[model samples]
Target: MPLALVDCDSFYASCERLFRPDLRKKPIVVLSNNDGCVIARSKEAKAMGIKMGVPWFQIKKAYLANGGHVFSSNFALYGDMSARVMNILECMFLQAYEVYSIDEAFLDLDTLDKNFNLYKFGCHVKRCY
Candidate 1:
């Protein structure tokens, strides 16, 4: 069976928005250490021309003018959320997986029953989140 990779997009930014439903769909950027650079950014933020590693000061004016949300990196909160996600994946895949990163994993599809439909399984996983 083929290996499947599961990863979260804009992880840090997504984590920040999880508790702030109001910020969903808005431009959100998660700053790097000391608020020095743009680390993770939401889809809206990317569309607004905010690139990763760009110094935050360079885009401060435009970002704020467009009602964008800025947040410092919160590794503690992100770590907890990631753990929760990994736990869910572990249970779903019967622990036949490896945590590739805080936001990514490699699941062993060979462990699943031969009758299992991968597409349906993917949709089910998406719905779970």
Candidate 2:
């Protein structure tokens, strides 16, 4: 069985940006509970050298000075968003799938047509949700 490992890249950061278009191009980081450490970061944030599990206070000043945005963990919003993505995959691929993590899923492609173009299907699947 051909398995496709589908993971949401920068999931927390991406979820935070879903409703805020202004953040689309900015470096973004999501702090852990009580705002102590960094948990997630956008691609731009990663490029800016913001690392996971780092103490937020250590980087707050420099990160803010360089136009970075920080957010507290929003579990409700993240969970709801994750479910929607999973639903899309389940509906399209049926029973041959597994939710590997909150932001990653594994889909079995054996149910698909052998002649199907996996590359194009993968692109379409990504755009689905």
Candidate 3:
């Protein structure tokens, strides 16, 4: 079966940045509850060598020194953003899609047009965001 997976990478940081556009293109990292660990990181943050699950204290000084933005985990916002993506998928796929996670989904491409250009279609789906 032809299947397609849609995943929103850096979902938590992406959600945070949505609210703070000033931090767009900047390094961003989301911390777990109690500000304990690095849970989500933006592309910029990852480029700075911040690894997932690293204790906050371990990288705080250097990260801030390089102008990284830190956000406390905000699950509500992330869930809402995820819902938006899922809604778009539902509209596009009808009932031929299954939600994989808050940040991921799967679509049954075999149910789509037989002449579908998978690469072009995938590009369109990605640009839906």
- How far out, in Å, is residue 43 in model 3? 1.2
TM-score of 3: 0.90
lDDT by residue for model 1 (96-128), tens:
999999999999989988899999977986796
The parts of candidate 3 lying over 4 Å away from their true place are 125-129
Runs of candidate 2 exceeding 4 Å displacement? 125-129
Whole-model lDDT for model 1 versus the true structure? 0.91
Candidate 2, 45-77: lDDT as tens digits: 999999999999999999999999999999999
C-alpha RMSD between model 2 and the true structure: 1.5
The alpha-carbon deviation from the true structure for residue 36 of candidate 2, after best TM-score superposition, in angstroms, is: 0.8
The residue pairs found clashing in candidate 3 are none
Q: Give lDDT: candidate 2, residue 53.
A: 97
lDDT of 3 by residue, 2-72 (tens): 78888897899989988888997999999999999999999999999999999999999999999999999
TM-score of candidate 1 against the unseen true structure: 0.92
TM-score of each model, in listed order: 0.92, 0.93, 0.90
lDDT of each: 0.91, 0.92, 0.92
Worst 10 residues of 2 by lDDT: 120-129
Residue 129's lDDT within candidate 2 is 41
